[model samples]
Target: MSDNQQPAKNHVTLLLLSVMLLGAALVFAVAADAPHTLVLTAAGLGLSFSRRTPLSRTTRSYVYAGVSVLAATVLQDQIFPVDTQRFYLIDGRYYAPAVIFLGIAITFFEQRDTTLTSVISLALIGTMIAGNSGATIVTNPRFPMTNGLLDYFHFFYGCVVAVQMLAMLAVLPHVDRRVRLPAPGRAWRWHRATVFWVSVFGVAGTVVGLRVAAIHYERLADRTFRDLFRVYMRRQSERMIFGYEVDLWRTVPPRTRADKTPVVRALAAQAPGYLRGRAFVRYGRGTWSSSDTGEHLPPTRPGGRYAYSVFRRALAGRTPSATPPPAPRPATIDLLPATAYPLGGLLAPGNAVEFELIADGLNNSNEGALVPREWDVAGGYSLALDDSIRDTAYQGPAEPPTEAERYLDIPGHIKEDVARVANTVFGATPPRPGTQGRLAQLSRFFEAGFTYELGVKFDPAGKDPILQFVEQRRGHCELFAATTVLLLRAQGIPARYVTGFVCGERPPSGTYWVARLEDAHAWTEAYVAEENRWVLVENTPASGFPTTDSASGVVSRAFDRLLVAWQNLLAQVKRGYVAEVIVALFLGLCRGLGRLLTHPLWGPVAVLSLGSAVWWLWQRRRRRRLAAADRLLVPTRTELQKTLGVLEKQARRFGVERQPCNTIRELARRLESAAQGPLRDALLELLREYETLRYQGTPPAVEAVAEFKAKVRRRLAAPG
Candidate 1:
């Protein structure tokens, strides 16, 4: 075929190819979570099938637009679960709109030359890359990254997409040249060797990259967090910018420790949990700060014994570090949700419970929300309690509380009505006086009237409304915890609010779903002396536990097991083992069928028979058409004489023609001598052949005549 004389490929062929690719993309989208694969595949397909343009170009451009939309949807779904201050999905609401614009912009130069096209292509790529990268980094500002590895993955992902785009663009020209149709009877064969090798290498490269990235992407963040922590701790800032705080790890001590009492030492021996942040005391209008007082230590000598029911909220869903069981366990560790603000102070149950707090930065100090775990103090020394700093005072043995200190240090605003309700719930007679009585009363009080619930409708009027709820005898976990802490504190017991998740849910495979936000809770802590330590007392009514089941439970578990099998089957199919086996079976069956269709002897006979059949049909059609045309066609002698007369008339009409005297042969010779001489060559050749055949009475072969007829008909059909 001539360089530009392509086969007649109309819009229909381009449409068919576009549909096939779009169908493939749809299948992928339905089966996989990542839309990028489908999107890039569609883009590649469009580039390959872009020969039938206007139609091909239009199809590709629109499909790209569709891909952009699908990708946006996938991205949106991926980001939906991460609750952050910024909109990570669209990376800013404008991101989707900007992408749409980029898609449209690419269409402007769809028909341009290579250089101009590349310019537009570069612009589109640049806008897409810069906009998306900016959106991600801007929206998720990494002020103090907990993991450096995660950042690296994020950065690498951008680079990979950019590289993939460039690679695809670089190969577009070669791909486009391959899909074009050829001239009649010259069907273009795609180079099987080239297509096969390129495809195999491309797929292998992709598989290797994805496998490597998957193994390492998630862990990068965690590793980086660890590395940066080590670096920040030892290195001084080369240049500190305004408002830039020191890295979180560098600011806090490596090992969190607390006042060392026997109880603290015992708890510490169990395990080293993240020491929840230290307690805060002074409160400014919108902010809360901690007191400068050091850790509290238990007192030595005792006048009156005291007991503290420290209620710790669970960090639901999170795995706990392995720790040994506590000695003389104070009571049941009632799990509460994170938001519940249990009343009465927060103190774990133990005669001399100690706290080892790894200070979480100052921003969240004493917001009364920290994960509370059994303390693991360094030494088996006694602790001295300091009223000013509730966290810790002295490092020694447990002590007794003075009567006035235990029962009369009521904050001025403890509503009398709230105290009355507390009296009604626990009674003036302490339940198991010093420790036992208080525990029993607390248990009895909660069991009688409260129910656990995931969410509590908070009252804006805080304490006053809580007091009213005490009279009502029913409230959510927060209300119960808040009321308990306040009442216990009012009655001379030190108490504080605590936030954490509740009990872990065990599933079949030794896996547990920790407390979720829905399990956020609160409870109370009261001081006692029987065990010579503070005891954690859960008083938030059991009725308040969330009623809904987790998605990771029974139903989901069964579905996931089934899903695993399906995935395995699909994996086999994608890897081609299943398809290859099927193909082999089909080929085995087809072996006999092929013999029937093309046995050595039969194949030659069948081909000859078909060719004879076609030749017969063509001869019949041509003979009929030639007979009709001949009836209309004058004899050659008459046509020559008429042509000579027309030339003579033209000479006479013009009155100047030297050609008027020329014979037919002379006129023909003169026409042949001019630059356009080839115009008469075909006729001359036809005349010579005709003269030889007719004068000699020689019969031309059917095939030769047929081909000659076709050529003559085609030549005569052209417009002059």
Candidate 2:
């Protein structure tokens, strides 16, 4: 080689060495947590090419880089099967090297810059950004997404990736740099042809390897996961944390952010009857969230219980003869909550209810496993599930579905400053003997510094919004919920972000109420038991809502009365159905027995029967008269006045009751003589509204009436 060419060759050699070193670093970092075989192969391939000669310096560098990437990918596939984990770049050994080498090849070898190149580069960058974005920070323990290390890393990595791509473009020649070959004699050309064919074969092999990878991913992605089903005997549930290491599954495209894509809509459709996975009472938004630990047993019997059966809301409506065979009786199903919701998808085991799915019974519907029954399990259940359904399918298998690990991915471009905050919050050590104490510490840390604020515009200006929120502590529930999942996951909890109404209502008239957009809430759920069951904990402050008083302000507290009514009604309804069946059977039996008794062989029985019928009619008429009188009886105005007088007389005994037309302030003043401070204040506001509606001018708003009903329901339902 010419001396001038030697310089270029040396430069390429140095570049190849840099690739090998970087690959080794990533392998070392990732292998400690999740080891991959690809690192060894990548190292060997790069070393092999270090001493080999190619037709030209340019060809040598490009081929060596390509081979290194291909080798690394093969190694990754061998060790970290898609079955075990999702496609996370840093978590898996091969992805980083593959991406890095590809970047190096595009940057160093190809010196041509065209519109196509720019377009391709932009496409890759966009995917990286999309993949790495949507992090949360939880200084306040209110949101872990903001506080977690991985999310910060994701944003940081994404930015790094973008910068690398841009830097590559800047370094590559803006104009075509393709080299031309001089014509040779026929005899010499034959030797050149043989070399060219060998090169082609190598390229073909590389392409085939990539094709095989694509096929493998396709199959893995299509496999259906198992749905967890069982009833827990206690609070502790056992489960395998499937997506703990990867964040890829949490990837939500910008286009799908607004509407209920298959996932969101699936959860929304089951809203009212859906048994919530956990309840976090602390967040500002009014709802139940799954972000912390709860007592294994219901402190009291779980209230607000609703029976859910997935009924097809808008089916294809096949005619009777053509309808599919009753959906195979929901034998085993995987249930997953929408990614948009705050609580992680809940998996239940034991006493599992028989399910009636809303869509075609397929796991791909993203409606996770529907666990039947009302009992709480201490640990998770063990069951085998068929892995044939895609996330799009809504049916088959009662096994805990494998969560996509991509959801845990941290992009390569997040700003460094955000990570600084994570280090401070999460600290160097993993928190605790358990998940709850760590979360409590995190919540307290955030509450001390951050103020919950909504409707603020985020400035992405190369800095991650999560990082900014950590520093500023002002954003909507989306930020809070995301942060909860991120931080908890960082603490080694299998957490998922969720967005949904915290709590809502059905009026006395049984109409479903639409929570205002302001009612949107976010939270997190962590996998606790083997059945993949989850519990909810809250870290929100008291003043997150708009009631006259903070204690009296919660929508759930306001509707506690109605919730009781609903539960009681449900239990009663179940009994009523049994009663109806019993009565029908009893009447049928009586008629049959009477017929047998009056047969021709026993004609005398006819006379007895006629007498019995006469007596029965007489008794029925007498009972009707008594019931008629009872129905017609009504309280007179005097009686109502007497009732009011009695109420006034016994107000103290029945508990505190404010007078009609009394303002909360007035009630407080009157109670000053006998009232305690905070509790008195809360009751004053609650009763103030009640007094006004019962005795003042216009009736309360439907909202107030509903609120009143809920309170009454709770009180009546409370155990003495």
Candidate 3:
């Protein structure tokens, strides 16, 4: 309504907007792993323009004291019990303390005094050191802590305090006198105080900027900021790129080739068969990707006899009989740490009748690949597939399903080459028109000519990798699988490229199959129009894939089992099951303690002993801080010296100087002689207050001290 009120309203609006921006940046930093620069810039700009009012010094001090009490209570296990098994929540415990200290520092900005500012600065610096130490102890187990670059815990708490301090300095009208015209003679004093604080903030900003730049440079040299943030946040799974991309591409050497990295272990009567991860329908010049944009199938319950019968008939290349058979046998699988992506579920060659997964988020893709919604450290699922009809011929309808079209996708660049190769291998017109005949002919072509070699490299920039494989007669499983899928598509058969792990080395006990990273294999699956099913067609030579005997060693197998157990433990921890167990154990212990304390005769003695011990501990800790108490008292003595100097300067203005050995009361009497009326009364009052505070153990209140100092200034300014 009024012109004077307009600027204040604008400042308030700017402050709200800045706070919102900073809050958004904080959320983004947490969720999206945003760059530190983005968060820092947002926070800095927000503080620069904000004009929110700060809490009064006394109110803020009370809040800080309350928070400190709460922290002490929680640390003592009186409020929140500390469970070592559930220690992951320890970082969250730092929040209340950080907020309290930051609130106190911001309140100090309202008072334009360098002494208070320095004290707040020192408090914040001390808090940073303690917070970082606690964080390091909780997050890492190793001792002799090394100061690493981009310490998220330190940076986060430090930023919170710094932002609040800057916001208070920027917004509080009392902090910067230039924002308003002051009274005559008082203008220079206010200007000097303003410059001093601004310079302090400027120096702080320069130091922080240099530290951030150093961190950024260090992170850039080793890895990206996103990766560093992931490590900091302990979200390692987010960095994993699941799907066919990593499996299909051979940019790096296979893990198995370098060293045996166990992926899965199966406990079954026979070999668990290939474990399919994902399927791709489209084939480009040198790449393969899924083109079937089909929605995931709804989760199904465990099927009984009827489902099994139907599945058996479908896989057998025959129409289902009206009568149903018995339920199929189940096979169990244990996914390992080396298996980076989710294994959807353990699948066999034929249709799965039932799946009992010991995990959640399982879904079946349109291309028949099983994918889980999230990554799991270790999980298991049992499924029963219709193995009886797996190798049978098709006997379904003539027309193919609409979904089959995507599986026939072939890039235009290699379409001609694919057709020519298919024509030469199986003849332009095959001996049989069915899917089985074409598959048999393709298998013979690979077996007779192509050689299996992991070392074979293909130049993607040149001709298509599949074409190179066909011409050179040498390549790995990926090239073989890609060529097979392309060849099937060329022959008017719908086929998709599949990436998974083949059944690897089986131990002497023969209880299970161990699938390692080296067991990662690729193949093709072609859809049969008659059977209304997709059949796996392996074209890669058997010699190229890992065999059951490749992995063997008593010590190695024992270590693998240990690793599997460790992985399972981690998975349980992630799922909160371990925390639940720990809490249950803790409650049981507390109940037992209550029973023990209720014993008739010893109960009173036990209680007394416990109380005495606690009291003794408290006293010991209090006495331990005696040296620190002496150090803290040094600042109060310095402040007294500063106050005496100010009083002497004011007396000089009145042209009155008592002897050096004169007491404060004698000086005050001399100053009173130089003055009269209210000025004389003020000098006597100020001297009496100072004498009581200095001589006695009791110090005057902050407000009382401020009032006495103001009286001295007013008296010096008045005309005698």
lDDT leader: 3
Q: What does candidate 2's lDDT look like per residue over 419-525, in tens digits?
A: 45555666766544455566677677667866666445555353455555665676555566656655655554555543333323332333222232233344555
Q: Better model by lDDT, 1 or 2?
A: 2
lDDT of 2: 0.39
- Each candidate's lDDT (Cα)? 0.38, 0.39, 0.55
Q: Identify the candidate with maximal TM-score.
A: 3
TM-score of each: 0.32, 0.29, 0.46
**Tens-place lDDT digits, model 1, residues 1-720:** 212223433333333333433333332222222244346445644553564433234577667756665544433333321222233213323333233333333333233344234433443443343323222333222222313323453444434444443444444433334346455342323454555567657755775677678677869867986898678644433311111111111111211122100011111112111112222222222122343332223322211111111222211111222444333322222111111222112222222233222111112122222232222111111211222222211111123432324222434464566577667756766542544565576568767756543223434455554554565565565456556656665555655433333423333543222233344344444444433333344676545653223336577667644543454343333223344565567788788657755888887876788789999999998767545544543354334333334334433332323342344454445445544333345544543443443234344455544555555545434413
Winner of 2 and 3 under TM-score: 3
Q: How many residue-pair clashes does candidate 1 contain?
A: 89
Select the stronger candidate by TM-score from 1 and 3: 3
Query: RMSD per prediction, one decimal?
Result: 24.5, 40.4, 19.9
Steric overlap count per candidate = 89, 115, 2
Against the true structure, candidate 1 reaches a TM-score of 0.32
